[model samples]
Target: MSAPSRIVPLLAEGVLAVEGTAAPSLSAGAAQPLPAPGRYLVEPLPEAPLTVTLDERSVTIRPGGWSGELGPSRGGRVTGRARDDLDPGRDVTVLALATGGVVARATARAADGGRFTLDLPATVARAPYRTRLTIGIAGSDHVLGRVDAGRPPRAWGPAPEAPRLRIKISTPNLREAPLWGDSHFAASLAAAFERLGRPVGVDCMDAWYGRTAPEDAVLVIRGRQPVQLDPGKINLMWLISHPDRVEDAEYAQYDRVFVASDIYAAHLKDRGLPHVEVLHQATDAVLFGGVAPPETRRSAPVFVGNSRREYRTMVKWCVEQGVPLDLYGGGWDGVLPPGYLRAPSVANRDLPALYAAHGLLLNDHWDSMRDNGFLSNRLFDGSATGTPILTDPVAGLEAVFGDTIATASEPEAFAEIIRSCLDDPTPFLARAARAREIVLGAHTFDHRAATLAAAVDRIAAG
Candidate 1:
């Protein structure tokens, strides 16, 4: 018999929950957080159950169970020109594979002119690290074509005479959109390089399988692990989430390694990682300007981040203290107590307005980020938006953000910070204004861009 189906709230922690029932145990980082309202995960029931709606975005079980989240926006897009001989009326399917695993699959009818586009789930974008594309008929298994579609956009703008420098950035894909919030370092850094009078190309780790940078390009790799690239002038911007685990041998291939924080750079330098430098995360002024209107401004404390031990501690403390905290990000649903308001993930572009609307923004870094004194990009983003923040204390935070951003070392201290921020707005607003000036003056993406250009120029000169 086919298994029965039940509606469950899907959480980032991988717990499956039915109404009025406890969630099953979830594994670390493998599970997604509890989805907010209007979202559901479909699970099989013990007994056979009739499914009434088996649509792509939702599934409904008879005897009253329904589950599913909204489908991906327009599916994963696959755009390629069709062959002149191919039938425009027939449907086509595009499949993305990584290490022989079906990562993303989508189907769409050919447009009138033989140009085809298919949208698959966004999860398909992250995968076996190498991108191999296969096109086949929608229903039949017959494969029609295969190609390694892993090229970064060849053109940034009109080509310059003897392109000054071609930098290919390799970073984890933050999100599908190229916005500052969901940036794959390549995209934002590309814009920065363009402003500095150099053309650049950007590629994410997922789509760069078996890919080699053009002979004339410099590969700027920024991620935890090493991405395979040919031997060249590689500048490794290592954002360490786990400093203790980083092996010097893994990074030996790169010529220079850039850490996001001074403390981290010092740590790696002491450990004998060659050519270590500091390149802190910063905010983009255009994206994070404190310009939200007065009517939409908020006064409550807002926390936006995914789960970690620190997050669990802070969120629980806030709940027990009866602090009216607003939570956003994934992996909290299964773990967090119900009735505490939870919001879906916010886009990077929307975060400035969101921060501007609130009186206080809460931040806590990853263990490595905190231990090694690496700053969270959210810090600069909040500061640039002129939003007051109460974050856990880090070694070098005060030196960079100064008194503009408050620090709370303990859970009790975090609670008190929330209470005080809400109890009176006067001092907090003043601090936020000061923080905005500091960010605008020395901590914007423009500043980072200049730093990046100078670093590259120095390397080229040497």
Candidate 2:
């Protein structure tokens, strides 16, 4: 019988063709019969080759060699074009991998025609690194592509050796969308460690709830309500907003306790956890930097917080007082009055801009825990965005934001504060801008990481 026809396209450079029926068995010496199942193995190819196998019938090979270099260098350019068929809206994340695992990841938005270019960090070590791209599409799973980084060794000398600080976050997940208030804190902390060049591990304490032991630093961000601690480990508890007051005996197990506000720190001190420190919550500015437009200055007034009973009450009071408030966040649905504008939970990247979009931002503490000294994430977020904040008069609020935040003790006072913000906005705006400059300059993730690393170094030295 005649051999099945050779159904795959055999093209010279730049030629294109649709595939046909199955290719015939190779005569003794055809280019080692393009691997079985028609999958092209182009490692030997000078450039990565693109081969398409047609419906089990044939294969078409397009030989525009792939240049595997990933990302740009300090003085060099990292450039590449993605096929138009790739998802456009999704971010194309390029990960640089070393023998140890992913050393860095850079994300780029696909151009109108699906092209992408990224500026890679120059500090990466000179080693055999691989690059992989992942595209996360809405309503679908992420798609990935792999390429061999084709660049030569960087001329920079060997990377400096730094002490490795490993931080483990006991939480549900580390995604940008947090299920609870503490989840947001945990995610931010983990991201901070990563930014500081520390290897961070996030494990669901709910999965390993009671299993606790002395670790490098096992940070528990609101895992339990009463602030349970493990006597065996150097446990650090990060009380996101507030927690039920624990007995003195129970609070002694924590080596370090971090509270978002001085009120909470005072609560911890009152409860006998004297080692507590007031580390104001911070926005992931790297993420928020993506949200607000660079050219747009603060415009609308806004409020961000949980849409719980207390929050809804505040929203209603604002509406009753005829205040126009732009609301952005989840859970405040039925609670916000009819006239309020609701923005979906702002993306981390968009938060800075979101804060920047509003002239004034409001922060309200839970009425039940008002005396407990809790400052919500909104305080930090608003302050970070240089948006003046109008909040409940709390002990630490004034200290942290100073003149940037105006506080009111009652609903009527709150409304008046909002009016004042509207009537004479310059002073508040200037204060907010100064506050933002302070936090961005000194309280950023990098700063926090440096602090944590120094603490870890001290511990190690001892």
Candidate 3:
């Protein structure tokens, strides 16, 4: 027996099909028809046509069509098809841009095989100009393609009158802040040079020495690392407030040298360096502020530092003395005792808030031989936050903060100081407030920048 003649819907109402040789038909008055053998390209009216596939089991309908390529200029184009099987009435769109700005757009109907074209502006080969191109589908919001053009060169001028001062600190990475040290010192120094309208660059001393030239002045902060320098070039070096490194010949090449403390100055003088100056470190108030006296006294005390050495000792003492202590910083591992809070590593922006949350902040010195020249960044952070500090009796600590900071000669003495603060919190709060005022006035980035600028001027004169 011959197979029954089958029929399929020619196209949905209002849908136009692209001309093809093999097309399916459907039986009269049938709710559904058998599978169609050939492909029928169709465009729906008023909207992009949705394409439908018919098979033995089911009928599948999907929205829109493949994207098509636009022509290429300096920019290129993408093109594809669209479908709206159910509606049989839809419009398609093309979007384009040039110079990063929108240049043109085109809308077309899918009825005539859904073909469309978009043109892009030509690329400019000259410098000192800008070029960009982008294309997206209309109505659907899907981006088709993108292109970029040339950018014009920026104008240049003569270098500034102020000297270019490059300061170097010895550390592995520029991103890591010094533990138990003030990162603001380097940042403030850079800011200081900026305020004087001088060109300044700060980086690791080892890195700076790698790029050192006759024109570059080098300021080494507690840097024990070796640096290669050119002898004939005018170079200035400052040891800052740090211990003397064994690498004296490396430091001796600089034209002028400075030390922050008398002890450090004497050590450099003993090494017979030329034009050594003793300049005490100063702080900037503008960068670090918002530390006001607390409204009510609280017994909560906190300490921040790496859990390397003397931290366990300090924590043990605080616990033994029945004090509520909180700690923020890493390296604790299994070292922390019960009742101590471990705060996540604080960011520079959030440091002020962290300090303000506590009543007192403790500063501990490393006990190794390297500790001699080390000064705590916590000193400045505490001062900036107006948190009363109970620090170790380091030589420079008193000079840096004066009588504003309470010093502890020993672990027992440190515990006693905390006890007294807990007993009469008013004096501690007063001391913390005073400390903030002192740092703001003298120990800020602005002040350091000026100092650096003046030093640079003097070096240039000689």
Candidate 4:
């Protein structure tokens, strides 16, 4: 297997259907073909973002030719040059999803997005692309493949139509940076919307330009960055994080506004942004739905998230209290003792199993988001998996989760929380079961989807 490599935005005219003839190759058609040292595809599309896969190797494309590591895109295999186009029989018309089976359209668009992510074209696409590329796998691990016989052309155009809503994700693709959460979050919600009989599709930020239909209501999962809004269609913004970056003018642009915090929604409403409503983050209960039997009495506290440069609250507390912690994420290099730092990230599809494997999960929040009263999605994810969780106290958490969640008021409280869980664990286990029931009932992505879907329906009707 080949190791991963990096590249950045290429101001490309179009996509080139290239394969890994050898290892992985990245060149500018100018950098002298990288001297053939490493195994890469090295071909230059020159004017567009290049995406390739090297066997089991992951690829990260960023700003430079290959350095920044902004995040990850889907890894692909150039295995035997995409087999010839074969329009298979429509025998597999039924899509088996978490919400049960649905007669999926013969067209190349997935109906139940929360379970089955995307449906690729049965034929090769040239341009005017509604075409979903490389990102072929679903959250449920199902894939939609096409029998493409045509080559990617160098032209582009736009289109519009049908009553539908599209989820705008921050991650460029599904198999993205291990810590990046938006794509999976969006996919979970998209499936829920489909279960309610609303047609939904997911798109990365870059795909918004030429592909978004004019009639489709756009749900922007506001996160670390901004995606441009098309005023012609019904525009909606759900401020999930980075509350400070969203200006008043931006809120004024959306027909509907959703903030993930109760206090933030109140603040917006008081500021006369009456469109704002409280829509907290959610989980896919069907996926992260069960508690697995313990492999060992492994009791080390588990925390999964990026370091974000500073020593996180939970890790800091555990360290000071002399408790062992199992950490997963990047940027914890100089701050941890040996054997404490686990893998930098777990894959999105693998998260359910990861959470299920743990005895206890610990979580914290960023100062900015925490101050804004925004709770992390892990709260929902860990709880949905029926894993006992200990987290830092925040406003509105108790109200949403009730005593189903165990929270600490300060660093000093971590000792008590940890000691109690290890000693008795019965109370915590009860809480976890209660939290799972509550989340599956009201806080799953389906619940949130129903809330937002009502608003979108009303706005679209007008």
Candidate 5:
């Protein structure tokens, strides 16, 4: 007997099969109606690589060679495919320009899938700097663009004076492991401001305590306990961790407040704090993308984080369950049965490869953050490596990650999920790809830098 005629959906509605071929019927759920019967080539769309043009000169973006150049004006037009594997309807691309102490950025989303344009502020200081340009869906590893101006542009009359937006960021010393996150976060924010043509200074909390900074500067503090800074400047408290630790009375001291999680913002507002904005943790996409995976990744699950009670519980459960887990973080000594941690601690820069070198990564949040939906920076870090991660479920996390991440409510579920993922790596790989696209699309440090620049501009205006 002849096999029943099978049907497959076409790329667009109203596409008709070729004459004599089976007329594939559209499902009731098909979005569009059938069009007049005619020949149609129905297939998946081809890859749409970026086509960057500078001053009417076409530049090819490749992995090893220099591609494009920007004038002192730092304005250009970019045309590329609007859709990617993640979202076929996506039409936007984010652009970031980073130089010595400066970052200029803009977004260009093509409406007609023809071309999009981006123009940076002409007043930005002219200098040679590395460019990290990323277009979502085009793939996250596009960091080869560079701007090589032989020298500064010729002076054209007297240049205009720049904006007065000097910022001084104070955080704990870099040597301290517990506070390294705060230090890295503050440094990244400072670099972003510098890219925006703002003079920024960062110091250990103790160095700036009870001391004055540059006149008319803005001071930003990132720590558990607020430290005294130059009282003369407007201080902004960047609560990176332990939102609940910030007392109600502490809210009045700073000109503005920034939290790392949107849910934390609501919690603080509920606690009567005002002028709070959510500045989610962002990964340095270029750095993470540069990390090369090891030739042999361990078959067992791996996790890279400090030894906390909750994290220890999950690790211990893995050991008891006969699953070999490699741990990387400080203070794990004597915590696990012998042979658990491959190394005492791994550098933050090495985290991406470490993540990529494993089939599965485990994550748990700080108790306060977990309860309040404050996603950890690890979430972004692991995702950037395109590695499957299993984290504890948080309320509203689906909005941020959708089905790209897996969550286990309890230790047993975590173990069970890990086993299932190990048995079939297909689903995990698929989710990792989706999550990476999301991270590159909206959660990179460039995105956070733009958000911070806008927020500072608004606050400075007043």
Candidate 6:
């Protein structure tokens, strides 16, 4: 063999081409923001050599450079047909997933014809959420196919020529806070509507002064920053948080008002704003839809949220009780004891893994929200991750989540619940699975998009 061809074959398939004196100060993998964590296809050799620092520490890799690919699936039912000359009745376990979380698992057994089908649970198979398929063959030392966790492609059709009333989701979050502000909510909602073949855009508060077009309708997301009503436009509002900041003037000219809390919706309607309705916040199904296997997940409690300028109740309880916690958020500098805080903030993309790693999620709502029924979006996001959640009491919590969630008004109950989870997590894991079904099936941005889209279509017709 030639010297170049016999160079030990470090990496398979010529995937990586790195040569340098250890490229310094560069961090790859999940640690940094750039170069997202996923498989990248190398098309051609570059003229200039790439510089990268390979970690000296040992790492695990598949023996044959595993490849995982999700086959075409519809309604969570993944089917396959092949003429295998190997063995009959040798079933391959198929795992259907959304993002990285396993939503459904099925077995595809090879019959005489070598044909097989994987029927993923319809409860978790919605097109709005991305889906991946994993096939685990028996008697394999290495995970053969690992690319199902990667991405797929889809193209959109051309837009209509009519003067359509597109939507503008206006929020107080700035252009800079893509991963950490209200813009995440706005952007997800816009994408949800876009998937339904509607034109939707997101504009931060600073850009909303004189930028609206006559063909645009506004959907204001009310949080800490309250936006004023636009009288000349078809304005709809979703009052999700910061109930105390809501003002009559801010929602006066809004064509429709969707409150997060049924109680708050009534409160607004009683004040002569009869256009108000209840519409709770939802989760990003594809992004926050997966859970790690039980054996692989950690059993410690995790909390991811800011202090909101005050010591959150569940966090204080965890600290006082000496619970081993993975806390990630901001505004926790002087409040938390030394070594208790894990990170100032967890990146938006990293939240699903964070939720999957921990056994339990610690959630809370502000005083106004808890009392007035304005459920925090955290509840929805955590539930979607399939993490058993222990949240502070909120009005109608039972009605919405049923018994899937554990509510603790006092520290003692909180401790009891955590202990129970640590001791026997089977019941909690079941609850988490049920909660994930609820979120993915009904409480996703796709569900909310239908309601919001109908409202805009009505306005356009009028």
Task: Report how far residue 366 has shifted in candidate 3, in Å.
Answer: 3.2
After TM-score superposition, what is the CA distance of residue 181 in candidate 1 from its true location, in Å? 6.0
Sort by lDDT, top down from the best: 6, 4, 5, 1, 3, 2
Cα distance off (Å), candidate 1, residue 149: 30
- 216-335, model 1: which lDDT tens digit per residue? 335544443334443433344445345554445445556567777888788778877778778777777777764663554465788887674344656777887777777887777667
Tens digit per residue, CA lDDT, model 4, 1-462 = 752332211211111111224343333442222211321223342443333344544342322221100112122111111110222221112121110112122222222222222232233233232222222111111123222222434221232333578877767554552346787788788889889887798877547556736446788898644555555566788888878756564577678889989988999899987688888888887788754645554576788877878888788888888887788888999888788888987777777777667668888876668778898899988888888888877778887898888888687788788877877877888888899888888888888988988887677566
- For candidate 1, the 10 contiguous residues with the lowest summed lDDT are 63-72
Better of 3 and 6 by TM-score: 6
Best by TM-score: 4
Better of 1 and 2 by TM-score: 1
Return the lDDT, model 3, position 406: 88
Q: Model 6, range 1-462, lDDT digits (tens) per residue?
A: 321211111122222212222212112332111121221223232223222234442222222312223345454455544322234445544443232234555554555343345565544444343333334322221222222222233332332432234433334346466554577787778778778887676666555545645544677776544443334456788888878765564565477889988888888889887678889989988788854544556768998888889888888888888777888988999998897788988878888888878889888877899989987788898889888898988997876788999989888889889988977888999998898888888888889988987876666556
Please, what are the lDDT tens digits per residue for candidate 2 over residues 94-125?
A: 43332223434444555433345544344433
The regions of model 5 sitting more than 4 angstroms off are 1-179, 210-215, 219-221, 229-232, 292-296, 308-311
Identify the candidate with maximal lDDT: 6
RMSD of each: 16.9, 21.7, 24.2, 17.8, 23.9, 25.2
Q: What is the lDDT of residue 107 in candidate 1?
A: 50
**TM-score-superior candidate, 2 or 3:** 3
Candidate 1 segments exceeding 4 Å error = 1-185, 209-215, 219-221, 238-240, 293-296, 308-311
Q: What lDDT tens digits, residue by residue, belong to model 5 across residues 79-104? A: 33322224434453434322221233
Worst 10 residues of 2 by lDDT: 134-143
Compared with the true structure, model 5 gives a TM-score of: 0.60
User: What does the lDDT read for residue 334 in candidate 2?
Assistant: 69
TM-score of every model? 0.60, 0.55, 0.57, 0.63, 0.60, 0.62
